[model samples]
Target: MQQAAPSASLPERARGVIPGGVNSGQRNVPGLTDLVITRAQGASFWDSDGRRYTDYHAAFGPPLLGHNDPDVVRAVAEAGGSLDLCGVGVTEGEVELAETLVELVPSMERVLLTSTGSEATFHALRVARAATGRRLVVKFQGCYHGWHDSVSLNVISAPDRVGHKDPISTGILPEVLDATLVLPFNDRDAVRAAFAEHGADIAAVILEPVPHNVGCLLPDQEFLVTLREECTRHGSVLVFDEVITGVRHGLGGWQEVAGIVPDLTTMGKAIANGYPIGAIGGRADLMDMFSSRPGAPVFFAGTYNGHPAVVAAALATLRKLHAEPVHEHVFRLGERVRTELPPVLASLGVPAVVTGYGSVFVTYFMDRLPHTYDDLLDNDTRMFVGYRRRMIDQGVFELPLNLKRSHFSYAHTDADVDRLIEVTEAAVRAQLADEGPLTDMDGTSTMGGATRC
Candidate 1:
């Protein structure tokens, strides 16, 4: 590893003002001081000390078109009319953005915008409760719905403590915890059991159809079908939190891919090409509940609900995604990684599972592909973290968390993917030096391994 430069002092100085020297807990790398990033463009960013890295973090999925996409930048610039707090109704850009969203998204009978995925999820829950007149909500274990009291339980915890009804953060009210019922992902029997027992009281059954929080675990067809059938039978609203999967998986995300429409959907991340925006869209009747025209309203409002310039950026982003081969490029690279990375681990004798869909993927040190979050608990977390540190040293940038998923955007090239493969093989060799290879398969393929690096 390189010696720490004086530039490291910036984060130390930030600690005096910001708690933990960062705005979000996820940014705090476990075994190393977080780098202070100075600038970013296209598929790479440089740290404060001028260290360059090909970024796979993608700001946790906001950079769908990559950093500073000129289309989004130009749109924002053209709409340079910044003071969007125009408390007097709506802007043309916001309306255009909303229309684009309604057209592209499967469940968008109506649209409501917010500035963050957390707020969108929170509002979606409120609509479910109000529409169904129920109090309890069912969320999957380890499927993060943001840091709100309603859905913050079990997103992160020690392995032994992960599959329970514990709150992920402190200061959440007990009532909030009680109102949320946490269940394991991809376990059909668990969902059936929960719905059977609390069917009458379950207002919403919300999950990330593809759970990306605790690594990338896909849904069993039976599991998703069962969610739809059971929720319909029990009169509970089904909500797909597609904040990370949206646009990256497809225009409509999980809904479009799976062909199952949730009553309400919360989208962000890739929606705005890295701009700050979130949207909740669904059936007209349910969304209309937000309007107090005749009856009571659901109390959903935000100051930056549809900031003009941000909306323009989102519009341009959606247009580019619609008119371009964005998905083709992302899925091609993603499929290459999925096909090739397993052999890399196999040759190194590292028992692991590489899981993902579309442009989001995660590497887990496990015996097989994880069926649920519980399945991921038995691996060597230290080895994974060590491998991540080694990859950083090799200039392949990823969030230094042990098991966070890697994200990719349209800006990454085949050459960048070559660097990713090279760095990954080196990291595996460094961290798994004494370990034996897990599988008998070939691992000498020079293949793509970019995405959530």
Candidate 2:
């Protein structure tokens, strides 16, 4: 196996002052810990120690176009010199982005801007409740809407807890879980039963149209159609959490692929090409609930909502996505990776499956592709952990946690895919050859590559 680059002691020392040695909890995996990143460009990143790697994590799914694209940087610089924040009124960039989004997805007649995907879902849920006058919300077992208490339940919960409908995280009030109903994915009968039992009380059914949280599980055509029909039959709103699948799939996202229009759609991550921006979009009639009225109790307001810099970045990103054939390139690159990577793993006698829809994909170590979170739970995590470690050592960066899916960007080329597959094959062979402690390497304890709160 390859040796790791010299550790960045500065970040480790700064950890004494900065809690957990990182700004976000996701950045700090217990045994697979690393310090601050020094720089990133295109599909590659360098750590503080100057070690370079092909970045498959892609900023946790925001770098659809790639990191530090010249167009996005130029847009940010221009917008930074002028208007940065627009608290209430509309800006030219914001209006342009909103109009472009509506044109891209005609089902979205209106949109509400926010700073993060979590905030977008939070506001969308409120709008649904206000419009339908309902109290319950239904979400799938492994679909993650964001960090909000209401939608945070059942995101990769254990099999036992999932079967019992228990919240995945602690400190969430029992009442919050009570208002949220959890069900298995791709289960038409279960969804039908949910609508039958709480049809009158369900305000919305929120889910990632293409679930990526647990290894890019795609729903069947019948299941997508069932959600559309069932939501219409009952008065509940159907929400598509396209935060990860928004532009990664197509200009219109999973809605276009599935051929089903939802009542509301939440988008983030790549919306601004790595700039912090989120949008809640849907039919004008339902979105109008956000307007202040005597009887309307829904309130959605933020100081940084549609900030000019982020909006300008979004406009530039959208323009690039439209002006260039980015999606076509993404499809070509995706096909190469999906086609070439798996067989390479198999050649090395490593059990693996490459699953994804469009530019985003995951390398899962399982006998077959998983259809649900339960299937993902049964995967060989030990092998995955070993493989991930070897990949890192071989200068390929994926999410240290195997459970969390990795992503690809338009910046990744055929050459990048070739290098990744080559390194992955070597990594697997190395892992299979080693008999060392699978739990520890180089004095760092491995976290088993499992992601949880």
Model 1, 1-453: lDDT tens digits are: 535456747777777568988887767765445578899998989988888888888888778899999999998888875555675588888788778878888888888889999999999899899999999999987788987898987775555566567776789999889898988888889889998899999999999988887668888888899999999999999999999888888887788888888888998856888888999999898889985224648876788888887788888999999999998998888777777888888888888877799787778777888787767676556566667777888778777664678877899888877778778888978876745332101222211111111
In candidate 2, what are the lDDT values of residues 31-96, reduced to their tens digit? 556556889999999887789989988877887789999999999999999876646567888888
- Of the candidates shown, which would achieve the greatest lDDT relative to the real structure? 2
The models' CA-based lDDT, in order, is 0.80, 0.82
Clashing pairs in 1: 349-436, 349-437, 349-438, 406-452, 407-452
**Considering summed lDDT, which 10 consecutive residues are worst modelled in model 2?**
440-449
lDDT of 1 at 252: 77
The window of 10 residues in a row where model 1 has the poorest summed lDDT is 444-453
- The number of residue pairs in model 2 that clash at the backbone is 1
TM-score (all chains, Cα) for each model: 0.92, 0.93
